[model samples]
Target chain A: MNKRILFAVIITVILCGLAQAKTTITWWQFWTDPNIKPVIEKMVTEFEQANPDIDIQLTDLTWANGHEKIVIAFGSKTGPDIVELGSDWIAEFAANNLLMDMSTQVASDSADYEGWGMATYDGKVFARPWILGTRVLFANRDLLTQAGYKENFIPLTFEQLNEATKKIQALSPSIYGWGSNAPEKHRLYKKFLPFFWSHGAKLFSDDGSMCLLASDSSIKALKVYKELHDSCGFVADQRGIEDAFLEGKIGFIISGDWLLKRIELENRKINLLSSFIPGTKLLGKSFQGGEFLAVNTASKHPREAMRFIQFITSPENQVKFCVANRSANPSSLEAQKDDYFSSSIHLQTFIRQIKFANHPPVDPDWVYIEQAIEEAVENALFRSGLVAHSLYEARKKIEKIKAQ
Target chain B: MKWSKAGALALALPWLLTFGIFWLFPIIYSFIIGFTDQQLLAADTQWVGFDNYRALLSDPDFLKSLKNTFIFVLGTIPLTTVIALGMALLIDKQFPGRGLFRSGFFLPSITSMVVIALIFTNLYQRGGYIALLSEMIGLSPPEHGFLYSGETALFSIMAMDVWMAVGYYMLIFLAGLKSIPRELYESAEINGAGKIRQFFSITLPLLKPVALFILVVNSIKSFQVFVEIFVMTKGKFETSTMVYFIYETGLTTKFEFGYASAAAYVLFVIIGVFALAQFLLFRRKQVAW
Candidate 1:
């Protein structure tokens, strides 16, 4: 009886000591919407349950002020162990050495994920890709049918799409053909660069020392865009354009998966059809954007933080998260092949388009470089026969930025 | 009652601490940052002396923003002041539903600027209400609507600013009108002055101080135009103001803290000069009167 009691007391003491050794890691994430926050919470709970020695403290951030908050947190050296960063933001932080070098950690598993190019700096991976998304063309079937086209006809080429849009627009004075982007910063380039890429234009030289925006292919792309803008396109910011498309006043709009989910949830009466972005010969390439997870350099528990990231970014967990997000897709190829995407035609179209999508150049200066590209597009759109001049000016500006 | 030095310092401690921490600290720190190449996330900050200031003088974007801010200040202040004066004059007299008119006119002023700007954004969209009205009136609106065109974007924002700001300034003018001792107007009437003559001589002279206040305050506010542009256009279509430029530089696109701080200091000096000029001009006018 004495030996048994002593054994029981030792077991209790060891359990208590193990409980006291639990490590708590703080994670700041941007999935705060009612429908999505629960998925994250559930994942964290599962992670904690599976690894009883580590606890996660989750903080919610809004899209509007999240960037500012992250910057301030890092500035004060109080950054969370794990933080979610937009794809475009990873380069800037990595360039500043604010993120931990994760190339060795993720080397063996890097081939399993997409969007590694965006998270890499100096050929080193700094963040892990989480969710990936691409854009597709949303067409109004009724508008096409009303304009004497077949009910389910899809435009596989730019010329055909433009012609059909013009005819649809001619049906009524209130109707518009293509929903083009206005000169809104951070948005117009996203709409224009696909065409630039479709025409085989490279944004920068192979050495990354010079901008190639003034190339013949780029000029041709701009000319094509201007022709579309003048023929039947209506200009507005992204929100206005989406609204018009939903209201049945626009024939076609190139938008992301969010619009597909929006139409499915809110207004199902509209006969919507999705298709790939039309190219000259083949389908045009779309822009790839995504969210990534990074470990802060100042983190006290880098191992726990990376383990949590890997746990949350596993194929099953990613598929679950994207299913709840309703618009985004998993960055893992295995998750992309899941039954959910294969079953839904609209989601399938986005998945297929991701195969042909291209990410922007991975550079620390891309933020300023994108602004220059946006200004060039806007300048070209505002004036006729100035596409070349605008591109030339943009090249000069980018060179100046690089010099600075 | 007499108080000890310790008691006095204790009473002033809270406000002094707040001022030192929030206002004075940032002002001085930003001033120092303006002289160096201080990037937000970069570890190394080097003193560049007057390079930032020199670059601002030649930067086309800064020059464009300066010009736009000036145009905004010049275009809106006079119009807002005159319209507020007119509305105040009309409502100062006993009229039906005077209280209702006052509240209705002041509603936009009290409403959140972001909400107002968003409402205006939809109103300014293509085929929106404003476009429909333009079409109905047999006028050709810009093909892309008001906010999309470079020629009309700033003007559209300025028009909205005037509409929202008129009510507040009108309230101030009403207070000034009320404080003018009505007997002065009666005396002018007794001297055979008509209503318009009395307004030009007695009311205008008495309201000079209020007018000066409105002009200075409106100039400062207009020069720092950012929220409307940020919400409605995001500094596109030539609508970027000085503050907006600084914000985009330091916070949004690039974290060029040094350049943005330099731009902000220039704006501060410009505002100071303008306010001083206004004070001097009003003093001269007051002496002449």
Candidate 2:
């Protein structure tokens, strides 16, 4: 009887040890929407259940302060095991050695993801593209009809867009024809980049060693943007523009797919349609922006973090999360072909637009470059500077940055 | 006695340690960092000496921000001081529902600045209440909203700041008024001095220290104006203040910590100079008194 008791006690001790040995992976993400938070929580729960030996701890961050918080955390060497970063932010983090290189893990299938380029630096992948957020042209169909355009008409070129905006502006003195964002740093550049891309303007040379901001195509793009602004008499930030469009005060706006999801959720009454951004030669090309998932360099449970990333970014799970959010497109190619995407014509346009989307250069100095572009745009649009002169000055500044 | 002194130090050790660790250490470290090329996320920082400061001297954006900050400070301080003093004098008198008036004036001071800024943002938007009122009064408002226009954005924010800040300063003035001996006013009245003469002779002269205090404090606050511009204009439309520029450089733009620190030190020096000048001026006046 004494021997039996001893064995039972030993067995209990081993079981408790196993339970206590569970690896906890802490993940910090910035999707704080009520609708999306639950989906993430559910996924975490599911992940924990499937891998019972791994405990997933989740922390939500607000978009406004999330990047700063992450920087502080990493700078203080107290970051979580995993983090969700904006695609634009990955370069800075990876350059600082704050992120773990996941190149080996993602190498087998990185091409299958839409925004993996943003997560790569020095030929090493540091993060996984979790979502592909691309903006398309959103038109108030009623306003378009009022402007004498045929029902379901979408502008295919800058000229067509300008003509439609002129007609729309004539419809009512209060109604604006085009909704353009203000020339704010970090924001205005993204709005204007799509125009450059559509005009076949190269921001950098083939080797990425030189800036081409003053190229003829680039100047042409700026002229077109200025023309649109002057014609439409619309000047506001993206949020203001969206609000105006929702209120039927604007006829045309270029915005993210999330706006469509918001309109649906709000059950807004306006007749709205989505199309690729108007292009000069090609169909509307846009700047590809998205979120990425990365493991912190300081994480002790790197393997567990990697497992979590893999689980969350699997094609099926990607579809599940994107369908739940209804705001972002899936990064996974297979997921993009899922029923949820195929069933909606609006979402289909976004998928097609994503094919032509290009990301900003993956340089750690991208923030400075973005500021330079914004300043140039602001000078051209608001200040008393010629577009060519502004672009030239911006190019010189960008060249200095690149040289550094 | 030495034992007692040691005991007192022991009792204060927690606060001393906290101050040293959280405040003094960061201030010193940041001063050191200001001499380096310390991007927040960069793995390596280089000691660049005075390069950041030298660069700032030639930076057009920094110069513009400095100018805007000065404008904000100059525009808001005297207005806030005078208005607050007036309000304090009015409410200091014996009257019905004086307490109610005090609370009403103090309400905005205690309210969250973020909420107030958001409300003001809407009011300054195109076709919002303020724009509508301006049009109704036959004044031509900016077509794209006050906040959107470079000419009107900073001034609009300045007006809001003055409105938001005057109430708090008024409370300070009220405190100063309460401390004054009623006998002086009564004696002046007995001398056949009118109310204006009593105010100019007794009230203004007696409130010198308090007025100086308000001026110094309000100037410091105005110089550091950030949240209003952040929430409303996002530092666009030429409304960026020095503090906003520091914040954007340090956190938002490129995480150029060293550059931001240099800018911050410049602002700190400016504020320190102003404070010293105010102190000297107040001391000279006190001597005259």
Candidate 3:
């Protein structure tokens, strides 16, 4: 009887031990795509199999409210162990000391990711770059052909683009020449930055102290934007521009790679083509932006979070995630050489444009500065305000924000 | 056993505690925060003591938002009240398909605001249904879209709001109409009074309280409009209402908690003053009548 009791007690102890051995890592991510969720779930399952003692608890956040949720979670000191942050959000979270310093973990291959600049703050790596994205010019080939353009013709210079837009406009009264984004605060800067960069304009000084929006280059860029608006007119927003292009109502548009994937999924046959943005003297550049994975400073299991980040950012995994999304480029330089990217002409153009892609300044106060730039662009384009004067006003506003 | 004070207190304790914790504490805390310089991401806060409020007074964006909100309120309330009253009158009569008409009108109010805003956004596009209809009717539509043009964007949103809100207010008016004595209309008709005269003499006077209630409620709602602006134009094209500005300041852009709190308090005061003024105006009119 005593031997039987001992055996039962030992079995109970072993069961409790097994239950207590596993540690749960709460992961909050913002990938809302139904297709991407299964991919991430499979990855999590693989990671759990590899690390038997760790379990991942995944929570999906909506893109519309994800940033606000993260802010609130960190403010209340109840954030998850791991979070998927936008590249631009790293500086804000790091400045608040809410993100763990992943400097040592990321030190080895930090140079391999082009988007590392956005994930670094104060010379310290706080996040692991996962995806890379850049926008390129997309043209409606049917509209171009209707406007008397040659087959497969792509505009490579600002002058040619301008002339092509006019021809497209003259083709039909209902059609527009260019599909451009309206002055939306969150995305307007992204739409305008390429033009600003191509005209040799700098957003800030080397040390990021002074605003250079009123510079001659910036004014020149604004004038070019104004000219485009006068000729083609701006769409209500990015989605409006995409819809206009999809409907064959617009000849030219600059958009992210997501549109290409969307066209493929919908089986849209509008003779759409992609190319680098038009430039005057140099190759057109666009915004380099993406998502990163970061460890919350308040996490109980920082090491496990770091492991998960590493697992997700591994070259093979990165390629898998990017391929599943069908829009984002892999942050891994090795993954960029994958056959999937090489086989597609659409992906090839984006890869080439990514070479000239530039990221916005990784400052905590960049949101305010971006608003100032958006306001300046809006005033120049819609209000018919003088470009130099609008830029000068924006400079004053940005200086005030910087002073604060 | 008869309830005693202590017994009542015990029963009310749960609700009172919830109210105190969830409602009262946040209000007081936010009010206190309004007097300080607090960034949500900053580690430390300083007691700035009305500096943020002072800044808002001189801030152009705040002023514009205030103006826009006032315009929205003025633009929506009267139209919504009149149309709601008209709809209530039309539906109150016994007619065939009355129930269907009533439900059809109320459908928009029952539908999700986000969905309605999105649908309206599409309709306001350059070649969307509204624009196409306008062009067919020999009216020149805006070159871009209704939402793309600064001149018409706010008005377009106001029109949609009125359409969406009239139904709910019409239901309220219907309730008010139901409470009135039908015999008064019968007596007036027997005295040779026309339908218009009876409506003006009996219906309008009796519905005074309901009208006041609708006016005050609609005004407050119009001033607090945010979701439509958020989903439709995102406060672009001069559609930045006061609430949208506060949302942008507090949540979206800089997370300037202190300044946003100050702005919010200012909006609260404006709403309170308006409500009080409306009550006084209507009460006096009622007493005189």
Candidate 4:
């Protein structure tokens, strides 16, 4: 009887503690490793220190499982207070009303966010950009020099890049000319989009109500991709594109600044020159992607949550997060001015070039469309030779989806 | 008196309620959702009748997924069974390092599926270790690692799955082996019957039930192969099984829950037919035994 009475008292005290505790905003992130969590936690800690009335609990998930879990959580209305969403996911979430409108918050002058306009949906920005990443050329200067190309004289146009790759291929049979991903990364769209832009094709017209992919401009983009692949004289196996680049088999590689994080570790001694993929001068474009930090609208403490997002996205914290984690070019204009740019001239070049980048449209179905386009293009270029038909078919599929 | 029916039902009540609310309700509701023509959120949804299912039957990707899923089940089951049976037979006898061998065989199963998939992706990588090994051994290594080519991607993933899952099913087979009433094997030995004959005559008849159980489970798992595809290929590699297509269509691309729900029912029917066949075949065998 005495023990039972003591146990009851202990349980009552625990319950009281739980009820009286500070409200914790549960946060979930797709980045699940020490590589990203430390800076995020430090930012959270500072916020918690500033606001003693609130607590932020963090959960981590791998990118593979991340989206599915978030969707399930959102469907069940058991979602976390905050979630880091990809640029494309914001459209679907906002369209479904699964995410809250932040335009009012921004209008209220309560939230100072730093994300690209792509994450905006119906005048409401759903995400705040954390890292600025875009696909560009990473040239192995040693390989280029051996092939008798000038060290700093990278191509300024797709035509020049082809000629340059031909020279590199002639230098060595064992080492390839250039490397890009297999069709599987669905990255063909990234490789091809700049060309599409240069050819005067818009994915959707000004109003986002029509498909321009089947247009002559898009066909011209297809021809450009075919020329690049064939003249590059190489293809990295699917998802193996990064590995191929890292193994030093290619003279030039087309991949992202995010990949540079992994690439620099391997070829620290091998001089790498990063340059913008020179367009055909009709339009200079790059496909921009980045992580974003946003306050959860459903959070019990939206004001506090907004404060945390602002603090983390601040220029000082951005530098800390970027440098500490070897992050891609920081999203903030101010953080791009840091000392890290001295050696990584390529990443700096991306920063200079990002001002000209029109982010790949934030259609909710972009990932799927990209995939179908990639497969169609790959089939047309590598397997069969139906470039025009492939573009048309892929665009038709996207149209059907958008129509629904 | 020890554990009353009322107490047992009370203990199970919470689980029943949970399944009823979260699992059963969602599944039933989804089947109903599949019949709707429009997006459930914001958009007006209406009865589409057989449109969703009809659309699935006509969709080339759905047909491709169905084919891939069947191919995956066919490829993995026999391979897993043979390997599992061999392991069960080998470990049934006491040998040096037998405990260590058993643990080593089971180790891959215990590693998180994502980790296992990553390790295999490297192993099966172009110019990776396996390629290097094959070249050294005077074998014709694939130009690129298997998954790069559409012909071998699904097979490559299926092979990795069999390697990971064989040990788990071997343990099941080992359990069945133990229950074979050792006297039967001893009698065959006394009659001077050879080991192979004894295996076919005595061991197989008894192991029929276990074999059917493993095959049915392997089919279901292989049909729903997602984690491996999710991690290694991300459904690239021609490895988009039914579950993977359902996953990407529902979540990765657009949230076309109606179409995805219909696809799930299609996969459900595929599995249902296979399960029924297994039940019929095994029921007769069980009676004969």
Clashing pairs in 3: none
Segments of candidate 2 deviating more than 4 angstroms: A1-20, B1-3, B92-100, B177-198, B287-289
Residue A375's lDDT in candidate 2 = 85
Candidate numbers, best lDDT first, in rank order: 1, 2, 3, 4
Clashes of 2: 0
In angstroms, give how far residue A301 of model 2 lies from its true place: 3.4
What's the lDDT for residue A281 in model 2? 56
**What lDDT tens digits, residue by residue, belong to model 2 across residues B1-289?**
4568889999999999999999999899889999999986777899999999999999888999999999999999999999999999999999999999999998999999999999999999888899999999999998778997788999999999989988899999999889888898899999999999999998998899899999998988888998898889889889989999999899876678999999999999999999999898888767223
TM-score of each: 0.95, 0.93, 0.92, 0.79
Residue pairs of candidate 2 with colliding backbone atoms: none
Q: Write the residue-wise lDDT of candidate 1 on B21-73 in tens digits.
A: 99999999999999998877888899999999999999999999999999999
For every candidate, C-alpha RMSD to the true structure in Å: 2.9, 2.8, 3.0, 6.8
Model number 3 iRMSD: 1.7
Every candidate's DockQ is 0.63, 0.60, 0.57, 0.21
TM accuracy, model 4: 0.79
Error of 3 at B29 (Å): 2.1
Q: Which of candidates 2 and 3 reaches a greater DockQ?
A: 2
Instruction: Name the better of 1 and 4 by lDDT.
Output: 1
Alpha carbon deviation, residue B221, candidate 1 (Å):
1.4
lDDT of 2 at B247: 93
